[model samples]
Target: MLVRLALAALSLHAVTAAPAPQGATTWYAVSTTPQGDTVSPPTHWYAVDTSSTTTPSSRTTSSSTVASSTSSSASSSSSSAPASSTAIVSSKKGVGYNDEYLTRELAISWAYNWKSRRGGELSEGVTYEPMLWGRNATGWATDAQLGLDEGASALLHLNEPDIWSQSAMNVTEGIDSWLTNMSPFYGKTNLVSAAVSNSPEAANLRWLQYFFGNCTQCEQETHAVALHWYSDSFNTSAFKTWFTDAYELLQKPIWITEFGVQRFTSSSNVTQKQEFLEDVIPWMEAQPFIERYAAFGTFPGRFVNDDGSLTALGRTYSETV
Candidate 1:
């Protein structure tokens, strides 16, 4: 009965459905008001499931196959991998949270926020990469550019543009904004393409295909494919399927910026998410194409509680090798 994926209270069984409806614009975002104020939207289910917990599944992988990386893309020797100093750590493990304390407690290697600024007391040792979350990444360049000089090797580009609720941009709009806001970093750093949702719907995953097809030079600017996955399924194989598809489609390094279970039922529990993490985290770490990753746990419900105590799911994720 040990469970883990994201929601521990629920069954550890792998989920088969996307947590949210396809094309749903209900995901979270960092938006800007007309008055130039940065806005934090409601976290809702997307932050981390507040209703349940998951176990680290004792580190068993249930997937039939991870996306088979091509002979060339899977292990092709590239420039020596970036040193540990890069904003996205070479360890390829991280947590999505604003609290420096949680990151320190978990001892994860890197961190990221929706915007480009490195938030509060995050240690200098924990490489912090910046993201241009939405279309209006106002003033993101000046701050993120500094990473170049600081040896930050990666820049997370637009958020989920396919989902109207996230970045909400069409292919043309997304590329235009990327060229304007992200192109400058093309050679200086690894530009992670827009992170799209893991939903099987055509729009969610196809967005990247459309983007790369249209922008002939975009592949040069993009060092890796930024990806995300959210579901209620307990099947670890499903996670692998998603990863395989993305890898085969893009044939580039993959950075799993966000991936977790969204507990929508009373059965959700930490063991489920724990199992999910145990299966996926280790798999991701071993994969050569999976350059980096961070579980989605911005609020207390995920890695820790409101009192700042590590939850069952958190314990597994932190202790995971």
Candidate 2:
């Protein structure tokens, strides 16, 4: 049976699902964290599942109802039509873990034994969303190694591409080089989005433009761009206005990679989180260019970790998306 399964694995199967009722649309939330990790909060992803069995039918004409008088020998023939396609909507969820530990485990489990473990099968039918924090040599190496091993897909979070004090143009060049070198092994990589904010160097329009201009390589590589928006820096209207304007300027599909209301002195209360989501998500979704959306940090704390988990925020994300 195993041998037979292996033999049949490469064959592509046609998949279809019922058309969304009237104006309804379906979006999938693919989780980005590892299968079983407790510390890191789960990252919810929205991906279009291109593989399914439910097919939509076309309208058919009724044969002449009054064909009783003639020979009365009628036959019906069926025609096969092309399948309909659906769009994938995905978001990022962050689970905390020492980066090295997660990457090492992933390499061992997914890459070496992928073929036997049905990686090809999984790849064919479902869109896997993996999140990568683009920082440091070790993290980048780990991400590349894991991709080679598991045959996994990713939405790389390149928030601060240059931890060192490199210019935005130089940083983009470096990223382009790194991705180019890694491509042979990784195949077609999908960069969900990238950002460069909260840095002293990246504080001006010239820097932002340079950073985005560098992202031209990413677009050429078919990677989508994610722009980060922070509430602390800008008010709701201002934030939306800036992003909308930027999207127009960039002329590429953008995802709100990270947006949240942070309470530094006290823990994040449910009210603040709820208000933030209620105000932001709908307005952002209304835009046509924004492809996907993700909230920053699943728990209440910062990226480095702190006390208290905003369970309410987590629940709200799951419920709303």
Candidate 3:
């Protein structure tokens, strides 16, 4: 098997079902807790199995039909095409694990076949985009050099340049660095802008706009917008607005490199956190302009556990993909 999906071995306590009224057979659905504990939820076997089988077959048929339709549509001129003919295409879901050494393993735990940084593949379907953090690293290759050496599908630049604890490059320094180092990779590979914090000034949306407005060369070179959002707000409206606006303003495909409901208060509700994941994930997946999204925190409440078992959020993410 290629191991394209995250498979976790949870500690399950199976309870024998009650003798099903003599002649009846039943099936049960397994549910996991946020702590990675597994439990069997009551399920009607026939309904569950029938629905599962039918859904996949129907989706396969639909996918085939859509592929054919898209091919036929591509042959027509853009001006002649119908406005409502375009369908929403989903981008791949990825993991944003902070550990460089556990890149492949964390990717597996989260069912992420795509990574943000380059590394050895843990399985057959893995792919990645190389990153250039900052000027402090030793023996770091420039973006252009890395692109030539690795042949990446895309290249990521700067971690969080607006935050002092991360890349810490001021606006002037960021522009200067981009012009000198990052600009060389312009035509060689898909150039992604430096990911900025949600902070004010040029670090977030403002910083991205500033970069494009000031640096003609940088603007011309940019191919995608990289964004990061961490918030306690569980609602999707706020995120949707920010995301859609970024795309409309920048006129570039957006990559939500990092996004999650971070615990901002001591009263942060677990239910609300899970709600955020359930709602926001599907919303992002439906956006055609969103090229990719990486969920922050693969360990504990974020998704996976220390022993490699998947948390509730992790399971939701895996199933969503």
Give TM per candidate. 0.72, 0.48, 0.62
TM-score of 3: 0.62
Q: lDDT of each prediction vs. the true structure? A: 0.62, 0.36, 0.51
For residues 1-321, write the lDDT of model 3, one tens digit per residue: 001112233212222254323233223222222221111222321111112121111112232342342232121111111122132212356665434223322322222212233443432333356666654434335533654565456667776655433454545566777776667667777778888755432236655665666677787787777888765467678888777666666766777877766442122475676677778877775566676777664544346565555565655555553
Where in model 3 is the C-alpha error above 4 Å?
Answer: 1-91, 100-121, 142-151, 200-202, 264-268
lDDT of 1 by residue, 1-321 (tens): 001223434432222244543343333222221111332333322321111222111112323333343223342212222232222233567766754334445546677766677766555456788888776776888888876566566888877665443555667777788888889778777789988876543255566776776676776688888888877667888888778667766767788887877652233576777877888877876676687888876455677666655667776776665
lDDT of 2: 0.36
Best by lDDT: 1
Better of 1 and 3 by lDDT: 1
Alpha-carbon RMSD, each predicted model = 10.8, 21.2, 20.4
How displaced is residue 250 in candidate 2, in Å? 0.8
TM-score of 1: 0.72
